[model samples]
Target: MQIPTKFYKIIAIFSLFFLGILIFLGVVFKIIVEKRKLPRLYIEEKNRALRGSIISAEGYQVAYSNKLYKVAVNTRCIDPQKKELFVRLFSIYSKIPPHEVRQKLRQKRGYVVLSYTIDTKTAYQLKILSRKLNALDIFIPYKVGQRVIKQGLTILESGETRNFPYGDTLTPAIGYVSKYEDSGYTKIKGIKGLEKYYESKISPKQDGVIRGKRDIGNNIILNKEAFIKKRLDGYNLHLNVNMLLQKNIENILDTQKADLEAKEIIAAVMESNSGKILAIASSNRYDPKNIQKRDLPSLNPKFTEYPFEPGSVMKPMTFSLLLEHGLVSPLEVVRGYNGRMKLGRKYITDEHKFDWLSAENVIVHSSNIGIAQLAQRLSYLQFSQGLKMLGFGKPTGVDLPYEKGGKLLPPYKLKSEIYKATVGYGYGMTVTFMQLLSAYNLFNNDGYKVTPRIAAFITLENGKRIFLKKSKKRKILSSKTVATMHNILQKVVEKGTGTVAKIDGLEIGGKTGTAHISRGGRYQNAYITSFFGFANDAKHRYTIGVTVFEPKTKHFASQTAAPIFRNIVIELINEGYLIPKNEQ
Candidate 1:
């Protein structure tokens, strides 16, 4: 009890030294535990690139991806005293009324959403405001639905959405996408048109990742470098479609559709030698950005999807084959049987009677009997193989999705003489508008069959371009045969059924076909009329096709379809194609 001052000092020093050792060991143990759990505490961040754009030939962005956001407010975390301040600030940035913001903040929930789709500018401003408010929140941890007297706000990132600048101009060809969710991640996938066809090339491929450590305060450590994996955006698709021209053609079809009371009008213009589709238009269109249930039926492009009996537009194809085989000549005489003749059990007839007609006049007049008479010269094998060579009963292999490769009766079916005669005039078979267009292009392209293409090339993120391979051209007819057919087709416009398609001072060639739409195994009163032709000058030529389905006002192609074909040519001339010298 009565120790000396020096002894007391020595005891105090030993006690202080042991206490210091214990504190040092505790600090080391805490550091070791934190280090062991560092992997779980490390921060992982990902950045995604924008989806690829769909660019038009005119350099317009037909379709693209844009970022969107969703904002939520922690109602329970908002200080009861500063509730008005939170509402005012949020209302100012979100463009929502203060009263509406107040109503949303009154909810007794963990987080209440204020806006599901705030724009980029608004989102950025709100994010800045969030950071400023978080200065105080950084020190205090807020739990879910705590009802604590504090200020708290949350902004969650929503995914990307597609934007269409031209509204519904491009239609089903441009296609559309639907949202898909896997695990906990969400994505948008193409479901139709060119979008579905080139999904791999136009969809995002990789997302950048960043791995780094965060401090206990959930802040990134500035001294440590993050490991990053570069993000890769999808490739851009540049199409062969001309936006202005496509609109022009669509306008033409719309006007004609209303005037003719036609159920539908489909048209396309293609470069003669290149097979590049300048424009593919339809009278019926729906918005890709906001599709409806009724719009679903209109999404399938009629140009590639719908097949029908092409009627007389197919006569030229059969005649070209006849010329190719030397089985018939333009000047050769054949009896027309006064417009009607029995081939097998059925009788073939023309619109006009004739005692005898030259083979050239047969095509010029679009005489069904005359063409059938010429077809009689060829055996079933010869006739069936000829249509097959003209790209019949096959898809044009367009880049667009859901292309139908129209049906052709087999040789056995053609063995029947009645079917053979009907086949010569575009019956007992079906073909799409694209196939018919491509078949007629041979006459304008000097007999070389060119494949139709909608996609021109693809551009990568690194400024490198990858062009789609061009389809190899096949020689299906001799140039001499082409010239003869061209002459006959030209006369059709100048003096026959296609005279309505003839423009003044411009030389055009085409054929007009009127076919009765069959329903329940019998021809109906409704008719499908069409005109397939070309607009040509010394310097340039373009193959154009127009089809009028179920015209209620007029049944003949010359009245319903040919005039539309003429208007298309005139529109081309107005757009500096085949312009006359005086107009130029």
Candidate 2:
């Protein structure tokens, strides 16, 4: 009656062998199970938070984040019989070609990403497509394992992606964030302009974590809402950037850049009394979204970075020095050296033939020869020190990165009289257009020098705002000198070289410069033409600086930059940025 011993032994051996295999698999897969669960566990512990918005003074969103959805398909869930139908219908929902969807559906192994960053409308339609096809299938987004068992289509809630509303319009000054690939992780950092300068204030770390059950897919489940840390939103930056003014300036510059076929144009507008930079625009700027084409070094707020010879623009600073030191008077007469004079080995000449002109007439006529005569009265020490005091050879401490400290020759190095003389008429030195803007503020701000600023305040999520403090003012010139210079500059706009800048009913004053670009220590045929002035109505005055680099058709500041300045001022008046003095 006993069973065969060989058969009994064989059955026992098979059972033991099968049991051993299970044990080995358990040991091996224990680590794999834990490793596979790490992503899900991490999501369960983490929260989701948002980034802050970068806004303009006028309350326009410059850089902000918006929610986007990813539409995907679980190929494994699709029946082979309905593959073509699924692809065709899903393609309609995703706006993708059916052929492409068909290929993914045919794989039938895992999930396929059908689309990314789809709008809510398309997402809703996708959900509808799932419902219509499966009849009982409801596209419940973010379920356990990124799947709705009844539906093959997976609708997922994705993280926010950034949106630049203005694109390149305010990019140069507002700047952008960059992704740094460091040590196998992507780190976001601001790499230029305000974005770079105020990174700490704008970009707070994302401490948000998803603390809920997620399906095998990393999507958070509908079972529990993510408890997120709102601290990551950081603080919103309200810049002194006037979006409309910025748009207008950019439009004008773009048109002029094309017409002139110039290399580039740099322009900015500032609140004269407060040193607030309202709008800065450029012909060349980087699109923040296009990371590949951006040349970081070339893209900048040019108004504060690029330096050029002041040309006649320096004449005002020099004349201010002469008046401040009591070395010159309004009616002080000086020979223009018959429109020419010898300085060291160079013959400094005026733009026109002049016999004699008063100190006031010198500025009124923009007489280089007259300025040279004034420079002769001062030693090199006096001239160099004067420029230093006027914010030359220094950065204006502007709220930007890579601000330039312009070239100012040492007094000891200025042994050559021509160096001193050329400096008097805006040569032998280089200053940024912004430094000029800061220096010229002295005349309008009653001889007080103010630092130019871009950011106005930081608004927190709690509804409290912290306004940025204005830079401390330093009196670089006496009030009497400021008034005298103002009167002289007004005359210049009224009846002199800057006459083109004069608004008919408004009082405006400024200087014109056509500086020769130096290459290899010699003056090139090219010139940096510019006009910077302050135009005032009854209530407000704005300082505007416009420069054209290497113009093809015109070479004079009066012709190129002056007209642009005039148009800008007239537009300001027309737009009621300036109220007429009579109206006031």
Candidate 3:
């Protein structure tokens, strides 16, 4: 084991040299691994480029994005000596003053957005100015601006607008969206109508995730770099509104606008069988061209935003309630004359003087006294329950923003004569036109109440049509009550104030409502006009409601609203809403 001194020294030196070589190799390997796994201290500077498009049900692009430039100033790269020159050049090019730019630079630690969505001409000018001024820190990032329809077949040229080629035609129903600057981010928000209701699905989130594709090796690869995520665009909506029917209704409203002297008009046409809204029109509509100055008044009418006493239009609903409870047969006799009766200090009267009338006559004549007597006879609890059954005091579950749930005063609150009388004739309490229409379904359908909906289906970008689900129906009245009320309402168009609403060729039924507008809690002589219509082909079928608020000349529904109903029904007949006599 022992060797010579010279050989031992040689072995020791070789061993030490080998150990030194091993340590150096280990150090080199460690440095390489550390470099490969090094955590970067700098933040990943990302430029957000967002865009959205609006397309019709048929995939016609209504609104789409166009290229724009996003200009930003990288404060970190701005030289102290050239800061003033950079601010001056930006101010001159961007129309922003130098003081503001300087203030922004002082407050900002990194990059500061100067302006977004600049036109190409302005963007180029700024780029040229930055180069001339030697402001290399100015960054002009290209992006897509929200495309607004300037003009199209079913759209109009408006300022960054979501337009219906039909303008103001479906304003109350379809709704509009607009861009807003809030909390340092630009956003497009749905303010009303269907825009607000289905915003989530229609307007996709920016942080949406995307799944990556697999490789051929059959082993999962950890290649985060290969996959890319982009912002998902919102889905397109196809409404239940029949274009032909909607156009016809709009024309009808236009034709009657002058005579009615109305401030606003709204009409809704629905299929009584399925509760699908066929057409909805709101008058005083603005051009979707100027979305920034959206005329909220005309866009949202009495249907959704405004609630008022519905007058005798609610008679069928009340009658349905009574008949449903078996409290009164349609033929049950009630005494009323001189058009007035006093109950519990509340005086009730019909518009015209009347005598003993059947329950059917009460609805036919819209006898306020007769209805009030009936209300007196029924327990308050029963009346409230019946109102609830008819979908009163509740939202129709309509997919619209700010849908009003009209107020229904509790029975205990009806201490005054005015309140009771008004309630009997659709006063004191307020209900939206949509709520009234939904409640009116009790007479047309088999006692079932279904929520109204605007969206027929949602079309994905890939051309998939997914039908929006409809709400379940609840039995609000007995089948017998519906049948009886149908007969009574039919008589209303045949012989009562609603006779003007009758279509010549088809059997039509409806009610006329002329409710006094309450000013400061007192009923004024001015009235809100209203008409409700039901058409049948040897059986109850379609229901429509039309309302015109605060007509200057004719305040009665029979005069102002009825003609609109007549025109709508005529168009519906022409479109084959009526069965042929031979077919029937």
Candidate 4:
């Protein structure tokens, strides 16, 4: 207040000069301090590995993952002067209309999507186009709204998508996968069948991460000091399925499905000695790549999931159990009740009647009364325990997902004569198609139960192969008992209920079953016809099973399922997978 005007002007000048210097030092300090912290505050980018593949036994890639791309345009960065050129180039590469491209570019938004799924070839071409535009300075790098437009074209990996080269072939067995949002990240997950069963082994658990410093432009600084965490890719699964054989089976089922007027058909072929599934097919298959809502019903593996009362097919198993316990002999004769008999309120009947029948003939003829009478001789514990040992009432431990172990009444229930008699002829219990097939396999495999498996091995990305552990066969019957049952089953095809399945030179042994489909606690008009059998010469041995649900044309399995079994044998021989002994 006391100073002169010139002194006050000098003091104001000094104050202004010091204030400018302090501001400069503060700016310098912020730049230096933030820059120093840049190494600690890194920009992290993750590179996820592709999902593993599913390889068929014949080395065909049934299911595999393919990398796709997402293409988008940064409208704000694109040069306004070269809009025509940009539209033309982008439209050509993206397979989109030029006018559409112009429309997208004209939008006020900084980012606009052009395509979500483009193949590698198209993505590469578009990336090349992006580089060319950048070389020509066609992108005006600047901030628009919240996005910094460093480039006009953006091509990013949209993650891997599953591809099935064979389309609908082996569906529900090869299974399917889908994309889902998990914690703000997109992930591909298996939805059904083997894909879901082996999800842990088939899906990548960890992704690669690169942590590095960024410059003022927020771009990753390329230096050797960057931290990198390598990605661990999933293991590749190898199935026991033979694609060619699987296709053949599907084709046969398709032809038979139309002729039989079946609601659905399921078939499977397995090696007798080793529990490897050779081919499993269904008539109601859908393409895993393009699944529709209607295909939902056919998405689960029916062979392992579907369970029904397996009618006469259980005769051989029951007979084998009786033989193992010395309760019945092949030549022993019993009353057949002339095709009908009453046991506790319900009547047991045969298609054709006989006053008396030999034990082996009871099986060959599928005499419900005779087998039931013979089964009653054994205690309830013996019968129940015997079937359980044969792998009934339990999952087959198969590699497929959603396997159902059909219901088997407890041994205490079998104490009732009605339950005992009904179960002896394959009622009072339920079994899946796979269980029946595997149980029948015991006879062919020398009474040793071999657990069925669809997958054979797994391979790592490092060229290491991990084979499945070999499971020892569990013996359920003596070799002599198996031989006796084998001869009995052979007679069933030669002249008995399964004669329709007999080929000229190829000897097939099997049992035919026809069970009423139950709905709302009542048996319906629909029937489930099945044929479970095996064919073997010196060179090859295979167990084949076929089930036709609600066949409109026929009721008896001998007419519906037996012929299908015969045709399958013919196909095996035709394909050189089997050799017939002699044909006159």
Query: Could you say which candidate leads in TM-score?
Result: 4
Candidate 3's residue-wise lDDT over 476-561, tens digit each?
Answer: 67787777777878889999888888655566788888888889988898888888868877753888899988888878788888
Question: Which residue pairs in model 4 clash with each other?
Answer: none
In model 4, which regions exceed 4 Å deviation? 1-45, 143-149, 182-185, 211-224
Q: Rank the candidates by lDDT, best first.
A: 4, 1, 2, 3
lDDT tens digits, residues 1-584, model 4?
57799998999999999999999999999878774422345788776777789999989998887767788877777778987888888888779899877776666667788777887788999978987888888888886574554765777777777888999988878889989765534568888888899998989867898889877655678799788899877889999998988899899989989998998888988999999998888999999989999998898788998889988899888888888889888998799888999988888888979999998999899899998888898798998898889888999888888899999998899898888888888887999989998998987888888988889999988979999876788887999999999898899999899998887667579998988888899988999999998998776788989998889988899999999888888888877878877732
lDDT scores in order: 0.84, 0.78, 0.70, 0.86
- In TM-score terms, candidate 4 sits at 0.92
Point out where model 2 deviates above 4 Å.
1-48, 67-73, 84-89, 92-97, 116-160, 180-188, 212-231, 291-298, 582-584
> Which has the greatest lDDT?
4
Q: What is the lDDT of candidate 3?
A: 0.70
Which sequence of candidate numbers ranks them by TM-score, best first?
A: 4, 1, 2, 3
Minimal lDDT window, size 10, model 3 = 149-158
User: lDDT score, residue 79, model 4?
Assistant: 76
Clash counts for all predictions: 0, 10, 5, 0
Who is ahead in TM-score, 2 or 4?
A: 4
- Candidate 1 lDDT by residue in tens digits, 382-434: 88888888988788888888899899998888777678778889887899999
Q: Which of the two candidates, 1 or 2, achieves a greater lDDT against the reference?
A: 1
Tell me the lDDT of candidate 1: 0.84
Give, for candidate 4, the lowest lDDT window spanning 10 residues: 33-42
lDDT of 2 by residue, 455-563 (tens): 8899887879998878888888999999999888889888888888877668799888888989999998998988877888777878888889999898888888888
Once fitted onto the true fold, the runs of candidate 3 whose alpha carbons sit more than 4 angstroms away are 1-166, 181-186, 206-227, 292-296, 299-301, 343-347, 414-421, 538-540, 577-584
